[model samples]
Target: MSATRRQVLARTGAVAGIAFTGSLTELFAGTAAAKGMGRAGYGPLVPDPKGLLDLPKGFRYRVLSREGDRMLSGEGEVPSNHDGMAAFGGRRGQVHLVRNHENRTDAEIRVPAVRGLTYDPEGLGGCTALTLDSANRVLGERVAIAGTSTNCAGGPTPWGTWLTCEETEDKAGTNGYTKDHGFIFEVDPTNPHRTGAVPLKAMGRFQHEAVAIDPRNGVVYETEDAFERPFGLFYRFLPVKPRGGLGSLRAGGSLQAMRVPGVPDLSAIQETGAAFDRVEWVDVPDPLAAETPIRFQDFGPKGITHAQKLEGCYWGGSSVYFVSSFARSNEGSAADHYGQIWRYDPARRRLTLVVVFGPDTDVQLPGEEPDNICLAPSGGLMVAEDGEGAQHVFGVTTRGEVYPMARGRQNIGTPEEPAWGEFAGICFSPDYDTMFVNCYTPGTTFAVTGPWHR
Candidate 1:
């Protein structure tokens, strides 16, 4: 971390670029640019004059929605803390975005508790739907679901709906909550009322993060985002009524946690290309967490595997890809590492370590703590960084080369005390033409279009 090394991709506080200025292309001149590093992903990021978003050449982003802005649907002001999201094809080639608001009761802007779409009046986190035309213009916005707590990351259904998960197990009596939180709710972009805001209690009630549905049989794989002792356990749900329409998961399902025989802690495998085969799943004695949370529950001597900061997942090919954001031994985790992306093959009952970040002190961009991930339209993975470095959405190549695709530049705080937000909800439109992501803190959504390297 010398001045010269810092200059390699120097990220100062100002050109830290919310109001932080500089031609990033010039800064990268002698290093990546001069060496022709743009071939990695799209090339090094060029600075933005507006200081909103930084992208590579031939790329552009439109600020689709901002927190506190009036909705085009006239529902209410946009809610804050945008987290996970998904994109669907709407009529006439329009795009429908079901975005998650990770708000709590004390949020600056709560998801408008629209009469019927509201789940619980006391709950504050929910999902919003926006219809954007072919030009990425917002046509209408509406609250798809509300009155839920900690609506973090969830995946889209192959049947054309969004699954929004609550990342909390907040009890109703505590913190003025009127209903118990932490359950997955299905949302139909075409019809919010059809969702009914009913909590899919069968999906388990612990700190849910993101879910990936196995299209082969409609089995849902879930991740936990807790750092509590005993950490978090990855879960799998087998819907009783598999693969139906919007309200199908409501029929209830059997929930289970993944257990790799000898690997109790996923962080213990620190190597990049390591693979753990023969995965096992144990039924959850109590998916509702009526007495104890699922992670802390007992499974006799052969306990389930645990990973820290389990977040973001999606179905890829015949497997489910998930993220263990980061782990620190001092935090009671079994081992320490920057991040880990795992591929679980349900057909073979195996878990493979597809990507592993740093255990080093310097947590830079690209490989640092990859959170929400999606299969890039062209190929490989588009990972959102949620670590100690300057936040960015990195593109990891098939050859394992990490490239900075987009950097967060919106200043959530004042220019004098600039605070940048992390990128989340990285998804592409159905036709794979536009990418949608969120700047979490002050809550901004961006629709990015670029010449993808397909």
Candidate 2:
């Protein structure tokens, strides 16, 4: 069984009573100044509830698809445990959504034709494409892409394509196929009828969870979703040619991991829940060939350090925003397990912490954990809830105005189910009037649409 965040925290000896640098009241009081949005509000827009989905007033949700539903490909049923997703504009006033199914064959809930890069009658988990109208109505659903391991969160390219990332680094022959694992697969939304799959091995193989590409430079920033080992590192894949297209990225590129110079071993400080204040950067060897990239710079006080497990990443104004789920505060008192959001500005080559959520701030109602995140249409952020009770879709305005956009419906699985409350992929439509969310458990997707108030 995979270790839960709580399990990992316990193993690291993280507990209460540690002194956090920012007090709960101070953190909440200085929201506007800290977030740089002027005066703003900080509370759930909607009250917490017990269900699978929830939304603000005047907004409604429709179930796009559920596990066990048949698709156009003649597949038996929709796979269980859906994860990351991306949207593409299609012809005939339709939108194509490429979704990820995070199921493995070993699990009890299984969907066929989802082994490692090959259709296995017994394995579950793969990618599917759903066609929707401009009004957020489903037109047709099909397996636009398939045959991958633990398909997780992925980013959409500017070239109108979807990059689906595999979140596993297990060798090919160990569990599933003999082919390489942990590679990004390109999906052509313009041509869903294509059969063959293209794997971009040049992106480097590791426990990749999410990726964001810079349109100007064609550079891809990735995050590692590792738990057991302390080797997870932030990586960047630089395309050989400037302004190169995604097609060229498939050919090859240089992969470099991030390093912070002059800092002490972050891993040890993290165990005590201490956050680093200094900043540094060291580039790893280019074109990292082995499964593990060589460490070129030692930024931590101790020689050579392991990187924190990075989850969601997005390219925003002038910088790349990423999240580290288990960063300690500087005081070495409290651990920010809920996670801290950071932004990396390539122009300045610096990293800055934008938001830090702890128990009091995150555990607002009863039980809740921050998971996947996306940029809001109004220039803020929308975070998916992967917590207990009912999962929620939350919005944080640029000014740090936090509100509840939706609440989960309780029909599919019990709150205690591991897959139940996890909200994975989230993205807004091209027009910015509609939002689509993927529920990891029960393997379902929801489209929420309404008029823009602002």
Candidate 3:
């Protein structure tokens, strides 16, 4: 298995979004902490003798599922390229996880195209639902939704569902696909009967990376992972039904793209403390991308803002946070940087620059293109790194300290050419006791437990 950032970026595109009050670098610079404190983390990592994963002294991980392992449903082997995921509490104290399989038509192990759960018979990427006991053991695993192409990352709904986003813009006849590929599908964790194979067409069609839903208003904030010239745009969805309960998203919705007045590109803002006070949104002329994608659609003279590789977004308090992996001047972005994390306060309509990974940093450091991020249970944030050389899952503290949480040691490649996998789906159980994450390559799910609050 190859690197997902490289694999996804090769066949398609990538990007990120979000905002905060100030820059992490600037905050630490003004304080006593180091800019990128590698030692301030949960102590030094204790290497794994099994050569699987390395963690801090007291932390440990257990492999829950693997790519080739037969699922309890007996439908097929677990699919390849495990990406974004979310966990929910079920009846009888069981925990349910809806996992995404980012496989295209050519992948070897595709999510089992089960009878009632499949959306497209010809498409090869979709999602799977895993049930685990409180003890952190797999109870059952089956196809949640299938027949969709490139199901990369998705967001959890306020009413208990997963909005699986397709990170592609492939057309119906282009690749033997029966239906247009770039759309969002809803997956129910507790009840598969509620998760029929239906596409939320009103959510807009494009190269979607992930979505973050606001609990107060049911407004869904989406990120696009498109790589073509202008890159991708961050979108906001207003559901007509508005968080009434489960399945409200299917009712219908209006989609709009975020526009920052005179700013055409997100990478143009180099300062960490820069802010967009009067944020504006423009209605997407073509939500379905019938001819042009949402990012390419015209937004009039003011124009919409674009970012390179908008990867993930999740809710933290009142703000919806997002990530922009990396930008290169040669790649059509305004400036180059390792990564950036932003916070969007929807209520106040403010976009603030919280943390920025400087352009001139070590490629092997913690700040290299942060991917799927989650607000830590303890107080700060947990960021998954999709950078080069050494791959690690880093923790950013409230004091603006960067620390290595876990490192990948699994050499999926041969002895001569070694390859380390990047972590994805960094989500915790409903109880906040065990963290459930996936190793993209070789497709492994881990249940990590330790002194997370410490």
Candidate 4:
């Protein structure tokens, strides 16, 4: 733990070019000037003069939206706890950013109720849409959907839409909520003025975390964020009508939980290089688990295998990569891993461990509790850290070497008080000229543009 940033990289065999800035603020600044940074990443992050986000030299970010900003619709101020997000290209050099507000009924600000469009009038979680020009300047922002619960991390559809997932299984009539809460709601970024909110109940009603779609067949892969007894199961939805777009998902798709051929439980994956038998899909009878949690059902341990804390997932290179954050032997799980990155190939029906983090007490980057992930166009991956240390967006090379990418530099209390919050929703703009990410507190969305290795 006493090793400097440079010493840590040298000690852990992490990617080179990571500079040691005594403070996290100067992180990427020295990285850019470092000799060994190579072409794999945008050298060390440069501290923001305004003290918001630290990036590499020549990289800059503009604050596109904040938690309490005034909404264009004038209904209510922007909600807090911004979570997952996606950016889409728009006409006239503009981009549409769809964001998730991970609020509970107790959140500081609500998305405001709009009568028929709200699922729970007391719930304050939902998605919002913001328009950004080529310069990454906000043109306008408005509430896309509201009256939901715990709108966590969802995924972007191939057909240009955002799927916002709820991370809670709070039953209706409880906690002042009148309707069942766990569901995936689709938001059209191009137009947020939809008539009513459409919850994809066919996608299963577990504590959903994030989702990724297989472009080859439009199969939607979902990750559950549950961590209590029984854990969470990775799920897939096969739209009855293939390639029918969101309409087909609404038409009702068959839900299936992922399982290993003969391994009846998750205990099979306790080692670093553990590889599972070929994957098998088990039918989930009720997608809307009105009673029992879908993960604790018979299919969970008997038919479908489960993992501890499955968080973010991304579809890239003909495979789906996902994360299992903060697992420990004491938790009664199979392994004692700080973080685990798994790769699932549908074509080959295989799931392999691509990256295994931790054996250190310091909670290193690149392997620290990886949350939302995005495959960089520059031949690597960007993973947001939600671990116990100073949070950072880590860059992992194709070879598994991890480096610090960016850090939170916002000053929330005093000039010396740095708000080190988790980074979520790391994504690239459709044009690849900008990277959009969220600082999960006093919520802030940043559009970072720099000399990225496209």
RMSD of each: 6.6, 7.0, 5.8, 6.2
Number of clashing pairs per prediction, in order: 4, 27, 17, 9
Query: Can you write out model 4's per-residue Cα lDDT over 1-454, one digit (the tens) per residue?
Result: 2224423442233444322111111111222212222455666666567877777778888888888888876877888998999999999999999999899878998887765567677788998889988888888888888899999899988988889999999888888888888999888887765525878898988899999898888889999988686888889999876685644678877999998877654534655446665788999877788778898777744567878889888776577877787666677676666667777888889877756655343433334456887766454567886754356788765545566678776645453333356889899987667889999887999888887663
Off by over 4 Å in 1: 1-38, 359-366, 414-417
| Candidate 2, 1-454: lDDT as tens digits | 1335543332232323212222222222212212333322232233325444655556667789888787755656787778898887777668888888886646444544532334333334567888888777777776656666777787888888777777776555758665656677777665644433667777877777788887778888988776554446677888776476547676677776665554433333333223344444345543323555333333345443344556888887566767665643452312335556666677777765556544544333322345688766544567775655445566665554455566555445433543335677898777667788887766779887764434
* Each prediction's whole-model lDDT (CA): 0.80, 0.62, 0.80, 0.75
Off by over 4 Å in 3: 1-39, 359-366
Better TM-score candidate (1, 2): 1
* Candidate 1 displacement at residue 118 in angstroms: 1.1
Candidates sorted on TM-score, descending:
3, 1, 4, 2
Measured by TM-score, how close is model 2 to the native structure?
0.78
Error of 1 at 349 (Å): 1.2
My TM-score estimates for the predictions, one after another, are 0.90, 0.78, 0.90, 0.87
**What is candidate 1's CA lDDT for residue 243?**
64
For residues 45-117, what per-residue lDDT tens digits would candidate 1 score against the true structure? 8888998888988999999999999987788999999999999998899999999999987899999988888
How much lDDT does candidate 4 score? 0.75
